[model samples]
Target: MGKSIRKISWVAFIASIFSFSWALGPSPLVFSSGNQKELWDELLKYKLWGRDALDFNNSNIHFTTVEGYAGTKKDFTLRNGNHIVNGHFVVGESFITDTGPHTFGDGYVRIGGDLVVTENAKNNTTFNDYVCVEGKEANPNNGVFKKGTPTLGSCPGFFPPLENDLDIPVLDLNKLSGTELADFNGGRTEHVNNGVLVIDGLPDNPEESRLKDIYIGELNINNNSTVLIHQNSSNNITRVFVNKFIYSDTEWDIKVSFDGETAIDDSTYAGTLLFYFHNGFTIPAGDRTLHGTYISNGDMILKDHLRMAGQLLSTSITIDADFNSEHFRYVPFDPPLVDPTAFANYILQEGIEGPQLINFELDRPAVIDVDLKYWFEVPTEEDVANYGEGLINANDLASGYPTSETNAKEVFFKKGQSKPTEEQTIVIIDDEFVEEFEILVLCVQIGVGASLPNGTTHQCFDLYIADDDIYLVPEVNEEFDFSVYENSEPKTVVGKVKATHEKNDSLTYAIVDGNELGTFSIDSNGQILVEKKENLDFESDLKQFVLVVEVSTIFNKKATTQVTINVLDVNEKPVFKKGADVVVDENSGEYFEEEWATERFSGSNELNNGKGQNENHPERPGEPQTFKFIVKYTDVR
Candidate 1:
């Protein structure tokens, strides 16, 4: 039966006013009020009739009344009434209150302004067409109509359509986290990469019987539902797992980048076009950081050890393969031509380090052995004809078959089982040897020296040596001579040597000294000296002399020492004679100085006016010619 539409009941108010008895009994009540005052009056009277059975039944009846600004205080004293309205119920803001716990028929009763009970009101469609039914067109007048009319009444033959009752608790996908969404045994449809799948929602305490099917469309997990991947269902029979997949329509292959977002399970995978994967997917090395793009999709099984270096944008990548044995035939078929040797070479040469490659071995001999088939490349027909068509037989692939040919070998891998080793040894070459050399030692000192009349003068030395062999002494030596009065110009010496035979070579020089005033040699046995002139001048005090001599060898090795020549003090002055033999004390200081002075005192008597002129005053003219006393002496120090 079509559920009848009803209004919000006023009996709730009736019960509130009459607390002690069941005045309106437990009958379905329908009430209407044009305004509030009349409604309250009728409710009061309904409560007053609660003392008797007849009154209770009579109150079970329904009633409705409307009054405008007439201000007529009419009271509705129904000895027995089911529903009643006694006041002017204004529209728009009128309200109904629930006085107590009341049970009514499934029929809905509404009191709001143009309200529809079932349809979700988040987006209002009823209010879009709401209009007031004036006094002449309300209820008994136009409210009742023939079947098929806009205001159609219920008809037995003309069946009234009814909507299915659905009271689904909406799940705020945004509110759930990845872990919280693990087991979703619900009646709602699930979202998969393909499209969607229907699922059942479990009862609060679900058993097999309580699992009800539900269909959902266009489902999306809320940000709060951070579960990128999760398995749903507690039972072992059926399990629902959800994973995130990126849908790309671009022509060129696109890679996914994960900034910081994560998927369920601590699994990592790379994604590509062919295989859907989870944690074992490959990703290009350089990509932007963002979530949502994953190289692979699907479930992943992690074994002993796994090392992935790419960006694991999404949940994980699954690697799943199974064999079909029922289709096997004994027909003599050429095994797929393959280069297992080359494959093995590739594995050993290009394989990534770590547990990237898995190997399986069994102790007992199996009934059959399984091997992968390979194809080799050929550039020409002659090459194919020369080498001939290389074919591998089933016997070559699987072993353990009866040698007698009675028993055939059936080779197949168990579901979810991986091949031990692909008959390939993988070796990753890492560190490389780069030839490098280091310099043991380096020193540079270039020297050039010349002998002069005054002394041997040499310029700053420049010598450098380097080699991977024995150390070589300087091939060039700088010498100096000074034995004449003419000024000698400075000479420079620069040279270097290289190591020989020995890996590391160093430069060492023999120590030498200067004994000749100006003649010197850089060799080990040489000596430098500054000769004293035939006639030398000295005055006042003792005069000290100093001279610098330098000695150097190969590799710029050098040593400097100061020589001294003291000239005795004598009362003499330097006299330069033209065209005469000139001499120079090469080791003496360039310039010289001496001190000489004389002290004298005189005494004299002046006139009586200047009697006894100050003896302390110095002799002056005229005024007194104050030459008191005089003494003189010549001294030199």
Candidate 2:
């Protein structure tokens, strides 16, 4: 049991066209020491800095410094559209304008706390780079720190604290297991075991409460609740750990959405949302504009108009209304690096190479070469021979692949054959020479076999291949026999159901089972109207009603059919069955002997059975009625 080796340069990829399965495992926090100013002061001491306006990688938090404040209120302006802030700028009672006489952007401003100036404020503050007045000295006469130089003290910290710490793993809801509590109640959980999860109203089954990495212990969210995150894209990230507080009364009705694209446009950064609050984070009144990131360990009571583009860490931040940094834009906080379960089981375990082991210190026996690259985007030979039969219209595999490279058969091993031999590592790719691309980038390159000694080293692994199309399910066009005419008037169309799809007009009709017998209604162009003509009664409804309908498509693909309908039964106008209180008391008037009857209706009595030779009235049985008798009323003397 003596075999240890380590040498990998890099080249990893894993995109065999969509396939996901990662039962929660990374990100428990692991960054021992890469020291970037001590990891930016330990991410601003756990405020986790990484704001967004794009640039989501090298742990973003831009703003090397920017301070501007001009006076003489002429429309108090500080437009700045120049934007660039890597960190360091504190405006207290805000007022920095500029519409002429420039100099306000290009960065540099340090004012730790207190720069108040409100009596309807003014302006006269400018700084293209350099204006320091932290706390310890220099007040600069209430407000006048133009274009640079104003130094004094404080302002050189910007995030730094957890060098080698590790303790955020507590999630033992009684030691889980029951398939991990049914995969955390089947939302595939991310974290949340403590307690309080109140999202107030609406969720007996909102697609099973669509969740995602939500570690809770207290997370109310009232004010007409809403917390959807149905993401099928946008890199899918939705963490919401709240170890203590996250109240919410009316920030425009405690909302948080993604999928329905909650407003603010441009796919609102496609929703990456993270709201970690270890202690306090309330939302008193209304107004909000969130893209993502809002870590608060304590104190963040924002009221009224609270616009946040992203990243707003807090230990204390109370804005009662209007704090508009032009709609609050300070995005930065890149979170997503939690690999240490032996490097996530050597890159998501599957085959088992070297079965796990790495001590390093080899003086001889060393040969670990593992290469696996599967990048796709070339399918058009009739979509690789009609891949698996139907629905094929691909093209969107993350949008970058078409240089041409296809080599799917290679695997070798020596030095005790570091585990190969399953036909030297099976690798098949012959879907009729596959092509129709949209994304399938899987790169895995781990090399080291030139007689070791750091001679051959490589490491690369990337994965993203999603564009599996195959949807063709709309058909609807089977049983349909209409008759109508029971008072027919409501909408009247009745028959026209024809659904067939290859996305033809995108389909979309419905009546699914008579619609509670509201009498039918299909329409998205599948016609079939006649909704409720008093529920169409052929003798109190149901002469033979069936309906069903269905037919969807906009990608939801569905189909159903069955119409029936047969309500025909009209004709009814001959009635004289007595009882207006008949009384031959008009001076003994005759022909008043009570029972003045003439019945013949109940599905239109067979027709024709007269007694005066000039008659033809059996409830208008085929129309030929001619049995007359006139009478006028108003002789009550």
Candidate 3:
């Protein structure tokens, strides 16, 4: 019954949030021993965590079901980020998209197994970040987000072997007064009232400090009697552990949250009440308003016309569904689930990003996972295989400023894996970046169950990181060959000198060489250009030139590179003046015929004589008188 209580919470929270029934509550109460008491308070760490979580606490493991849910934020800091679970979350009911779009995020969800949603969930869900399931998405067509699924791990949770142990501290209901019974609060819950086993909340224990559960018997709050769970500014939770069952017949609801900040001030808050039933629980028939996390070790049946902002965790959960009938709103644990570690009171750290390493020493070889807001409990070897390796969730996406950059992944240790060479395992975080201010990072859950000698089952921590960015030296290189016509327009850009600089430095450029012909130039932006295009000739003595440019940053770091410039040849068209008219006569083997001839033209030239006398086409006449000219002449000077 001990571990069963803890495991019960695992499946309990995921199976059903609010229901009033108990298939196992009474049996555990009768035979509840110290063993059963051990396994207490392991509410489905995330989405779900039980042998039969979200499985409707069925007779077997086949059918897991969920009717409604919510979680939509970007930061996992205050329970506003991704709500990741290592187990399977199943929704058995099928509702249409219009009455749908169940919100399970701030960011998104990353789980190991398949997230099977009933058919209706396909088009109705809104995911800020993709709901990544390593296994399979039964209705893959659902939700906007399907990115960032983890291939890291499966949640390792201890299943409640027997059931919740309700026989602890022997609650003796005989010596209790009406005021103490009606309004239960502090004190021990071990007393034997005459013969009947009733609770009086007064069994002496040396360490009667901090918070303890108020044990009450079978309670029926009918006739619209509202149960009030007290809450103060400093304390926002109250645990009520019952041995039998709790039933509410009227529309009045029970406050059932252990993390509600304003439960007492405003009835609207998830009240500081954790109503735990060792057997079963219910608000039979119809009830509209409820606030808190309802937990059970037995079966739970949900009625109609209900509106709640609480959580449901039970061994077996069943909700009566009707079209347009049920509504469940999600509000992060008001004060969220913090560390339950012995020394959770001492964990606030500060440091710089460096070659720093954090080492973990394991007592035995088992799976260990770093709970970066993604894991509620340490994940097992089985958990890793399902979700491979990826970012589990984001605290702020680390982009509250720019807002949408994902850069955090949940880490895990392999099960039965070999021991480390040094200690057991080591993790290092080294980032070089420039930041305006220090950043505070939060990893809400951190522990490896009993795997570590001094480890607790659960813990949380915060760390501040200082800015440490480094600037490197500047690098410059040669701007390669570029071609330009023999005559290009002055001030035309031929090529550009380029280089790399750090620290947002400004670089200036100047031509160090290339003036051998005084025809090349460079601008401040490193543009290579020509000053006098006419001076650059492919056939001239200066057919090619080398330009050496220098570039320096604001820090005065200098570098020079050689840029080769080649002048390209542009072909000039041949000029022709009306060649001396050629005359030819027919039969001019001896007859006169226009023939190509070389003659002095005052300049070097070659000409073709037109209108060759018709030697082939004996006689032909045309009004336009288009003539064919054939020229084969020698050079003339």
Q: What is the TM-score of each candidate against the true structure?
A: 0.15, 0.24, 0.31
Could you give candidate 3's per-residue lDDT for residues 331-428 as a string of tens digits?
22222222223112221112333232222222333222222222112223443335322211122122221111143233344433322333211112
Cα deviation of 256 in candidate 2 (Å)? 31
In terms of TM-score, how similar is model 3 to the real structure?
A: 0.31
Candidate 2 residue runs with Cα over 4 Å from true position:
1-129, 134-147, 151-479, 482-499, 503-541, 544-548, 557-564, 567-637
Name model 3 segments beyond 4 Å from true: 1-128, 132-208, 230-237, 246-248, 256-263, 266-272, 285-292, 305-310, 321-637
Q: Give RMSD (Å) of candidate 3 vs. truth.
A: 28.7
lDDT of each: 0.22, 0.39, 0.39
Worst 10 residues of 3 by lDDT: 72-81
State the displacement of the C-alpha of residue 123, model 3, in Å, after optimal TM-score superposition.
Answer: 6.1
Best-performing candidate as measured by TM-score: 3
Once model 2 is optimally superposed onto the true structure by TM-score, how far is the C-alpha of residue 478 displaced, in angstroms? 12
TM-score, prediction 1: 0.15
